[model samples]
Target: MQEPQSGPDRRMFLRATAATGAALTLGGLSTQSASAVAPGGFPDYTYVRTLLTPSQLKYNPTGEIIFPTVRGVYDKLASPLGRYYLYYAPHDAPGGICLAYGNSLEGPFTEYPANPIVSNKWDSHYSVSHVSSPHVLWKEDVKEFWLYFHGENTTTRLARSKDGIHFTYDKVVLNTSMMPAGTTETSYARVFRHDLPERGASYVMLFMTNNTTDHRDIGWGWSADARTWTFAQTPLVRHSDVGAINVGGPHLLTRNGSAYVVYNKDKTSGGDIMITEVGKDFSLRKHLGVFYDSRSSAPENGRAAAPSFGTDGGVPYMIYEAGERLKGAIAVARG
Candidate 1:
C-alpha cells in the first residue's frame, strides 16, 4: 500500500450532488449546507474520548496465545447479555480470528481458551494464510449469531454460532468473482439490519474492495437470509468521493429514523473515522465529518480504524483499533 498524502485533499469530500441536497460545511471548509453533527444529539467527532486502553486488554490468562506482541485488537461487539466480545488477529503472520470476553468495556478481558475461533483452516475457498477482521452480528429473527470475516484480504466468509462463541463455517459470503471486473480483493465487511420504509426489512452489508491499483473503496450489498448476498457493481463510498487513498472499515449506526455509515479514511497508519448519513435506500446523504481524528488528544487518540458502535445504558459508544497496526491497541470512546 502507498503512503496517504497529507494535504487538504486528504479531508472528507462532500459532493453537492447527494439526494437530500443537504450540504455540510465545517468551519467554512466544506461546501455542504448541513452541520457536521448527526441526528439524535450524537456528538461531533472531536468529542470522542477513549475509555479503554490496549494495555488493559493485553494480559490473557487462558494460556491461549492472544494477539501477541504489537498486534492490536481489530474489531469488537457488545452482546445483549452484558458481555463484550473482542475480535483480533494474532501478531504473527497468517494470523486468524481470536476472541476475548469481558464484563465491562474497560476491563481485564479473558482470552478464550479455544482461541482463533475462526481460522483459515476452516475455509477452503480462500487461502489459508490469514483470516482476520471479523465482524459478528446477532440475528434476532433466527436467534443465532452470524460472523462475517475475511482471509488474506481477498475474500469474505460467513459462519454461524448458536452461543456467539463456538462457530461453524457456513459459506463464502463474498469473493473476488462476486465483485466488478478488475477487482482484486474484498474485505472489511459490516452488516446492518434495518427496516427502511422503502426497502422493507433486510440485512444490508458494506464491504471494502480493492481495485487493480490497490485502492480500496466501500460497496453495498443486501441479503434476505444473511447467507446469500447481492452486491452492487459500483462503489457505494468511493475513494475519489471521500478524497482519501482508501476508504473502508464500514460500521453503521441508526438514529432518529435515519441510518449513518461510519467508516475509516486513509491508510491505517494515519487514518481517521468519518461518518455520513444514509438515506432510506442506503445511499450516502450528508457527510457528517470526522468522528475520531488520530492526531487528537487522549481518549480520542491514535490512528483510529475498524470502528464498531454500541450503547451502554442508552449512551452511545465506539470501539476501534488505535495506534499503528502491529503496535496498536483497542480503545473505546463514549458519546
Candidate 2:
C-alpha cells in the first residue's frame, strides 16, 4: 500500500504480478458461482456480506480501515480476548492498531471499548505520524500473537501479546535501510511460518516495497524466530512479471507443499487480487491469474485488495479489503 497523505490527499495512496512468460487464467471460478472450485484448486467464493466498514468502527480515529485479518485461538479458556480476534486500522494520519472480536468467523465482531491498542503516540518509547496495515500471527511454540505493522511508511515494527489485546512493543523487524538501494518505502507485510531449504529459517515474510521509480513489488525476508530477520537482495515478485503497474498487500497461501503470494495490482481495468506460485524455496513460479475477480462483484466496486484466508468449521473463507483504494470496506466470502 502507498503512503496515504493527510486529509483529501490520502486518496493518493498507492498510485499502484505474476511469473511465467504467459499468465495463466483460471476459468469457471466466478464469484457468482460460489460453490465451484477453480482449476488449480482455488476457492470459488461467493461474497457473503460486508464483514466490516470504517463506519462500523465505534472509535475510528481516521474514519477508514484497510487491513482485515483474524486469528483463531485454540484454547478460548486461556485466551482473554475472544474466540476470534479481528485486527484492522486506518491507513491515514494518526493511524492506529484497532481490534474487534466475535465468537465465530462469520461475525458480529464488537469493537474494543478503548480501541487503538497501540496508538501512534507512546511516550518515552516512540511516536510516529501514523501506523496501519496490521498482520497478526499466533506462534504456537511461544503461545503469543506477533503483530507486524508499519509507521512513517519506511519502517515495519513488531509487538507481542499473550492475550492478543495488550501488546508489548518489540523491535523494528523491517525498514527501508534493510532494502535494496533504490527502495523507498516498505510496509503492508504478511508473515507466515514456512520452512525454506538451505535457509534454516522457521518463518518467511512478504511485504510491499516501493522503489524510487514509484513501482511497488513484493519484497521478502527470512526469520529464525519471527523476531529478527534477514532481507533478500531482490524482490519476490515484480510488477512487470504480472503486467501490473504496481502491486502490494501480500498474503502467503500454502497448499500441497506449494507457496503462493496473493496480492492486489493497479491496472487500467481497476485493481483485483492475483496469485503467483512461489514454491517452497520462494522461487517465483507461475502467475495463477485473478484469485478473486473484483469486476464481477458489486461489493468490490471493481477493486479488491489485501486478502487474508482462513477456515471455520471445515469451510474455507477469505476476508479482504474491498471497493476503492483507501476508501473501502472489509468483505467476506466462503466456499
- Maximum-TM-score candidate: 2
Model 1's C-alpha root-mean-square deviation from the true structure amounts to 8.7
Q: Report the C-alpha lDDT of model 2 over 1-335, residue by residue, as the tens digit.
A: 23332211221221110121222223433122222343256766657788888877787776678988888875733745667788988989899998888877777778898888888877666788999999999888987889999997999999988888889998888999998787889999989999985898989999999989998999999988888899997888889998999999999888787888889987865687888998878866688777776744566888888988878898888888888877888888775
Candidate 1, 1-335: lDDT as tens digits: 22123322222232222235654444556454332333334653323434334354443322122221111112223333226666665434466677766665554456666756776675355557767677787777776778888776778888888767788888888888998789988887877786544544388888889988888888888877778888889887777776788987887777777777878887535678777787666765677667665664443244667777655456556677765554556666555
Pick the lDDT winner: 2
Taken over the whole model, the C-alpha lDDT of each candidate is 0.64, 0.80
The C-alpha stretches of model 2 lying farther than 4 A from their native spots are 1-35, 74-81
How many backbone clashes does every candidate have?
7, 3
Residue 17 lDDT (model 1):
23
- What CA root-mean-square deviation does each model show from the true structure? 8.7, 9.1
Residue 315 CA displacement from its true place in model 2, Å: 0.7
In terms of lDDT, model 2 sits at 0.80
